[model samples]
Structure formats: structure tokens, C-alpha cells
Target: MAELIGPRLYSCCNCRNHVSFHDDIISKAFQGKNGRAFLFSHAMNVVTGPKEDRTLLTGLHTVADVYCGDCREVLGWKYERAYEPSQKYKEGKFILEKSKIVKENW
Candidate 1:
């Protein structure tokens, strides 16, 4: 029989709390406040802080900080709104910094 396999996931580096599934990743090429980041279509076990307007490399956007639900460690940010029409596809997506997350079940 084939062995059962679990979903590949990314966990918080500080607390090992599952944050996102590998399948949910939309893009691996992104920049975070600390370093490299990944764009995910969905994130789990995380908390989003207050929304704020910030000017990024692409343009102005409304975003909220994302933290680990278990440890409260800052992971990245979620795109709340994109002012530029070209960047609208990122709305509602989550960004998780590579430095803040570790791979699991890979």
C-alpha cells in the first residue's frame, strides 16, 4: 500500500506553529521587511494586526501585520488593498517572510 502523505507546510520559526501550506503559495519571489518572502493564497494559525496604509515598491497599499497565533511572533503582512490596478491581484493575499518560517513535512 502507498504510504499516507501529509500536506507540506510552513511553520513559524519561533514556535513551530503551522502558518501556511506549500500548495497555497502563489509566488516565492517577494521582499519582506527582514528579507525574502513568499506570497500565499491562504494562511492558517495566524493573527492579522491593524490595517495601515504603506507605500511599497509596487505602489501604495493597505496592509496588516501577520503574527503567529500561538507565539505572537511577527511573520509578515497581508495585502488589504492595492492602490495600483496592476497590483490588485495581491489583495487579500498573505506574505510570510522566509526568515520567519521554516519548512515542514516536506
Candidate 2:
């Protein structure tokens, strides 16, 4: 069985609430060789769905999928550039701010 790596809060597809959460962890190097410059190889499944989707076509546009634990809301997402150079990935360029949180009154 795969180990839980990354308690990422995500919203349940069946329900709009964001209680359903999963951990995403990638220890391998997912750059250059991996499809699309670099990607989170090991835990790619966690962020990406099995089947590709329309518009995105691939449905693997997710760099990071942050869901809410309380309301199961799709809090935020981080997209990645496939097969690009590693330098393209700016350090500390990605972040999840406190403002992204949607506090419900209920």
C-alpha cells in the first residue's frame, strides 16, 4: 500500500464540502525525463485524476490540489509546465496564502 505523504485538504466530488483530504508525496526526480519537463512522479496520481478532461484535455494540469477540511471546498490549485527546464521553476514561486481560506459563518 502507498504511504500517505503530503494531509492535503480536498473537497469531496460527491459532496461540496471539503473534509476529504489526502497526502501527496513525491521523492523522485520528476524533471526532464518525466512527461512535461518535470512532474511529481510518485504522487502524481494524488493530484491528477485517472482520465483526462476536456478544456484541459489531459486533466493533469494540477501542480497542487488544496482542498478544505471543513467544507470540502477546492481551495486552490498549482499548475505545472511539462518538459520544461528546471530553471523555469522559480524557487519559492508557489505558495498557499492564508487569504485562500474561505471561512464559513456556519
Candidate 3:
């Protein structure tokens, strides 16, 4: 993909306090309500508090929730394998591990 002109912030779905962006993309991450709205929703965090692993999310134990730095909104989540306690995944990382995006305002 071509490089975007601004910073980009990506969040995790399972854990509400976690958020990330390339050290190089911090500024562009704060675009607006349209681009950063998902960062503040439970749909992204999965649960407001601790959540027991569901059978459907099968094998997903460790959940990392994330949000935006500027508005402190929900952005996404990252799910870790129940068997493997590591960060590396074969198919690349899955950000926003379980949340759904209802709108694309941002």
C-alpha cells in the first residue's frame, strides 16, 4: 500500500487501554471524529471490564484493547492464542481482534 500522508493510530478490540501507532505515524493518527470514532466503543473493546473467553472466539485468551491517543476513543483489540503465549502470528497481526465497526465516520 502506498504511504498515507498523515499519522495513523490502530487499536485493539479485546483490551480497552491499549493503543498503538508507528513511532512515525503518531500525528496523523488524530484525524477527526470520522476517522477515530471506533476507538471509543465497546464494540472494539469487547467488554467494559474483564471478559471470559468465549467458545466461538475459540483459543483466544489474551485480549488487548486499544484506543486513540487524542480523543481517547476505541480503536481496536488484539487477541492472543490460548496455546501460544507469544506476540508473533503466522498470518500477520490481527488488530481490533474481536470488535465490529458500526460506522466509518473517521
* Model 2 misplaced regions, further than 4 Å: 1-64, 79-81, 86-99, 102-106
Q: What does candidate 3's lDDT look like per residue over 1-106, in tens digits?
A: 9655543433433333334333312122222223332222222223332334422223445544434443444544334334444422311222332232321212
Model 3 residue 46 CA deviation (Å) reads: 17
Compose the digit string of candidate 2's lDDT tens values, residues 1-106.
Answer: 9675544543333343533223322221332211222122121112321222212323233244434444444433344432234433422122222333222222
The TM-score measured for candidate 3 stands at: 0.31
Worst 10 residues of 1 by lDDT: 2-11
Question: What CA RMSD would you report for each candidate?
Answer: 0.9, 12.4, 10.9
Please list the C-alpha lDDT of all candidates, in the order they appear. Answer: 0.97, 0.31, 0.34
Candidate with top lDDT is: 1
Which scores greater on TM-score, model 1 or model 3? 1
Tens digits of per-residue lDDT, candidate 1, 64-99, equal 999999999999999999999999999999999999
Off by over 4 Å in 1: none
Q: Which pairs clash in the backbone of model 1?
A: none
Listed per model in order, the count of residue pairs whose N, CA or C atoms clash below 3 Å is 0, 16, 21
User: What lDDT, from 0 to 1, does candidate 1 have?
Assistant: 0.97
Q: Put the candidates in lDDT order, highest first.
A: 1, 3, 2
Winner by TM-score: 1
